[model samples]
Target: MKLKKIGNVEANYSFWQVLVVCSGQEFLDSGEDLIASFEINSPDVRLVLCLTDDLLAARELLKSLAQKLIALSMYELELDGDVDDNQRALPYQIARNVLLQTRLPTLLLESCSFVRRDITLLPAELQKADCALKLRFNRKGISQKVLTNTLWLLPNSRVDRFLAQAISGMAKTTSENEERKAVYKALQACRGFLKVAALPGRYADRSHKHEGFIWVRLPKEKAETTAAREFREKTRARFARPPEVIILHPKQDLGTKSHLENNTFKRRVERLARPGRIAWRQMARLLVELSWERGKPARLVPLPQWKITKEALKNYEFAKTIFVPHLISAQLPHPKAYYYMQELVPMLFTVDRNGWGGVDSI
Candidate 1:
């Protein structure tokens, strides 16, 4: 919150810099919710909120949360007199201007969307490629479309310049649909210059329900289309793997009325909750073990005679209600399950070298 120096810059090759475009009260509310929901202080992650409106209340709100954010920063963008009435171009304009000053890898996000803790997964993926994008299958199923609002770009002069130019082109377009098409085209053209990686699942935004499930959800006609077949083959050839397909258990059919019936729903919940409880207990036990190793004073030693501090007990109880539910939901054949297993689970079990446990305990 105090802009404390996190770690030696030379030790890390890159830091995670997040950019949020804020204009209205709704955006501010979602941005605030994002801050409160997850532990965003990863030492290498910084959040930048770009304010484009002259809202005094918005400034006050962000100021109040300054102490709550460890690496939060703000930028005020001045609108030109020729700005259009629709204000559709404002987000891209702000992003282009900010790109000029961004030295580290940057993630562009919409203020209305909330990213879960799996946001950390992008940095590692970005490190291996020049850019990472959240691609979703279009309704036509001929090709995949990029979610422009949530994009990741590594700090390369060419990549940044190319993306900025494409965004600039999009800003000048009057048609909303054409703007998206223009950006998608731009990404395709620049693929030769950039090694692009796909951000799997709903890591970018919860609104992307079909992020990683497109392969499994495709209709037979769409799947058999020549374009769709070529797209699949090209993706596998380029990335050395097919698009991830989330397989729901037969009993846990998603978005189906039959599966949501009384008895079926109860059975499905019970099946997922069993593993959720086991994962929760294992997490709690690790916290207790770390607390003992740290030599913390125990308020009470429960059965098994393991010394558990009040802080650890409170953390465990809090996780039981919050994290356990998330864990269960993550395991319920959702598109984000693999992301949870890859990033969230290990993050929860990790014990920091500073003697403080990871987010699960601290």
Candidate 2:
């Protein structure tokens, strides 16, 4: 902190300008860790949370958070693809949208990341470069060629004048080629932010020079073998297991109702709740059948919509749900995290066409 005499009045400020983009609730717990670590040590650091896909949805949930110790702010960025609209995927959208955000020296991190040590060292290193890149890989070891989207840092000098449109344009093509291409595209964006070099107007060959990226290997998520086994047993015992289930999202299903009021809105809610009610109806049938066949109570599995389909998911995760990280894997912990979420937060009980647990619900 510093104080300067401006004419007669005194002014105060911190030594460094720091910004962090914490996106998604899957990372909110880890976000808390970032906040506590940064705020306690550096009182002047500014933290920003970026919530994508839905603005009203995120606002509703965030307002419910009662942690007074926490202090932060948010900006809603719509980062999702529309197949019917034939739109570009999120990565490109992210590249384009991020260009317009703050022009200060900034540090970007995902919801999965936690500050392992003092972050002061990170800023010091980043100050040397126009842009610094970091990525996490899924493989056992780290590779520069294969990059994961996790973090980026940039100083204000370059960001104040970077070409937003070009970086976003490159992302469009990069996302289409392959995973390696996507990695290359992000690198290009960093360079653009620094004004070191701008990508050519025309798309180039698959290969490109690797620049300032520093690969950091993160610890693998926790194990959930027992959770999966228990879930399987419960599913088999009660309902013979479902084939597939669709987890509806408000932005995709109920966005049309965003402007409705009174009776119009009520009608949309009833219409949207149809799917959840139907799933409950199926559960009811399965319960009755199990009661007759087993002569006693049988363990009911997660609602059909809650079943985990992706073999890669941990802790019986449903990808789109807030439980993806904390509740799905033993890795993340939160106030009303994972399976216990609905018990503490009533909004999580249902996800459907209408916004109940959704953002616009309130």
Candidate 3:
């Protein structure tokens, strides 16, 4: 069967959107991390959640999340029978299918991995290129493999043709391992039409290993001075009026230090703080006091109590009504991991809120 086109290549989309495919309970556990990473790095970009599995719990999780993120959109993927059976390749197939329908410059984030740096800069990097992927190395360090699926960023100009060819290449493969090899071969086949660029030091894999990159921290005085200036600039751009209460929680740790060196902790803190500063910039108009409490827990200040917004409730209802029935009809087998999601839902609601507070502690 021929692929159906959903978007006009010539159509103009003013903004970029990121599509994240979530399937089972792993998403339920790490979904908030993905959202936080984006909020910290690319808050302006619209987030589209593509739920590939017919799991009611997965849809429910997104519905609750959408209320807090007004810019979020949710969609169900109608997977082809053969494609649906390949669990390893389902995400790629879903991405290839979604690329067919949208003209917006889109970045496909691997559902299991979260980015640590500013991903918004990738689209501009791809303006002159066809697609961009982060580079990874084997243990020997002599060979480099393109992380094509990990953080795939594609421009609208020729993305459809590229993905279509890549998917076609995968279709010819019989094994999961061969399917991946086919994608790499497909990149070579489309070299003339596609220019794959490398995004280094910008992403981390599932193991949370920082591939041979060394992080150099700026001098403390210079770093704070720069952060304050950038904070002021971003605040003015995002909000017409300044926010009344601006809380800076720099001490919060994301618990991603298992593979990081002790010295790299400070650099990681500094890197994480950039997103916090960007995220909370709108909450403060002027920089009144700048203080650094290195290695100290931020003293909690009483803020307004968070309540579930009407939009969130509405989205929950929409998920239960619209997505549930469709998912049921698809009859996708519910994985055992999905059962654990129910236990996490309440914790998800309590921990995830729109307010400026810490979800993790150092």
Candidate 4:
């Protein structure tokens, strides 16, 4: 049977809308340093994979995510013309048949619009297969609870098959222990909020360049008093690099919804929690500030959106300052926005230190 097209245009719009909605909602606000740290430590999570004919849809989703999410990218996989030839099939097809089927389908039920619509139409065998597979996979050497937690929601469908196969491929390339350890180590680094490189772009051929900045998370209650100073000193002693460690906490304000009536404000807040500054920008701002506070003459170039000026750049270098790039409004490609900031902050910091002053702004 020929697989039906879900209208790439429609699918793309649908996917884009999903991304925007998810991004706007408080999806990852629980101070999950794991996600942020893993992105910095592992490349796989950084790149997003899409398997559809809708290139426009894929692009839209990728661009939007690069702008909003911490670290993300999009890739399009092409299934071969030969329907029965499994070797030539696309990764997404495998994902559909495998990952989305088994317990993984449950995730779709929770978050994915596409998967939810199709779950009701899948067969019993596929569902059963998915559940069994998840049960077995979770028991395997891969001990990470996060991956298992995500897979427990798979639906019984061809989608499950595809995901299973894709995951298998990932498994073969890297052991589960390796992945889990990597995640743990990265989180350890980020918990105290160190500056790191940005995530790689997900598209198959995009240049993996550092884009911007992000402030990593720290362990809870460690930044309140003398503990904060000790933490900073420990960082200074360990890396010989005392970074500008910023402790971030959520704050409620009436800036965006203040103009509305009380009821409307309440509704908006209820619908979705307000988003904080992306981690990368927060890191960059800190890097600039710390360089100045330390009496290190540096060049600071604030990206255009951040609003640092060219004169500000000159000021940083002339008087124990840090010059950041001036903020520009050009739209960035996929994954660069959040991922690159990790690398970008340090690069800018290095530049400021080397007396490379008075360059381009924003």
Error of 1 at 81 (Å): 8.8
lDDT of 2 by residue, 1-362 (tens): 11111111011111223333333554444444343333222222344444443445444543333122221222333334421121223332343244344334444444443332223223333334544443333444323433333333343435433323333434434332353344455455555445332221111101111221211223346342464335324433423322122111121112232433432323433533454433433433343344436554322222213222243233223222322211322333322222321223323343222222223223
Question: Model 4, range 200-276, lDDT digits (tens) per residue?
Answer: 11211011112211122222443424643343333223223222321111112122223324433233333223223
Question: Which pairs in model 2 have colliding backbones?
Answer: 27-111, 57-359, 315-328, 327-338
Q: What is the lDDT of residue 85 in candidate 4?
A: 26
**Pairs in clash, predicted candidate 1:** 1-70
TM-score of 4: 0.21
Q: Candidate 2: which stretches are off by over 4 Å?
A: 1-44, 55-58, 64-67, 70-101, 135-150, 155-180, 185-362
Give one digit per residue, the lDDT tens place, for model 1 in 1-362: 11222211111112446666667585556645444322221222355666666678876766655543322233334455544343555665555555665556677766654433224334543556667666775555323366565677666666766666566666557764666676667777776777777776455543323232112222235423474345444322322211122111111111223223443323433433354334533444344334335543111111111111233223233121111112233223222221112135533533221222233323
- Candidate 3 lDDT over residue span 150-259, tens digit each: 44545454666666666666654565446556566666777786777765544433333333111112223543245433543442232222222222211122222233
Please give the lDDT score at residue 331 for candidate 2.
Answer: 34
Badly placed stretches (over 4 Å) of model 3 are 1-14, 70-84, 136-144, 153-157, 172-177, 204-362
Candidates 2 and 3 compared: the better one by lDDT is: 3
Per-prediction TM-score to the true structure, in the order listed: 0.50, 0.36, 0.50, 0.21
Question: What C-alpha RMSD separates each model from the true structure?
Answer: 18.1, 22.0, 18.8, 20.8
Scored by CA lDDT, what does every candidate get? 0.43, 0.33, 0.41, 0.27
Clashes of each: 1, 4, 0, 70
List ranges where model 1 is wrong by over 4 Å. 1-14, 38-44, 70-86, 137-144, 174-176, 205-362
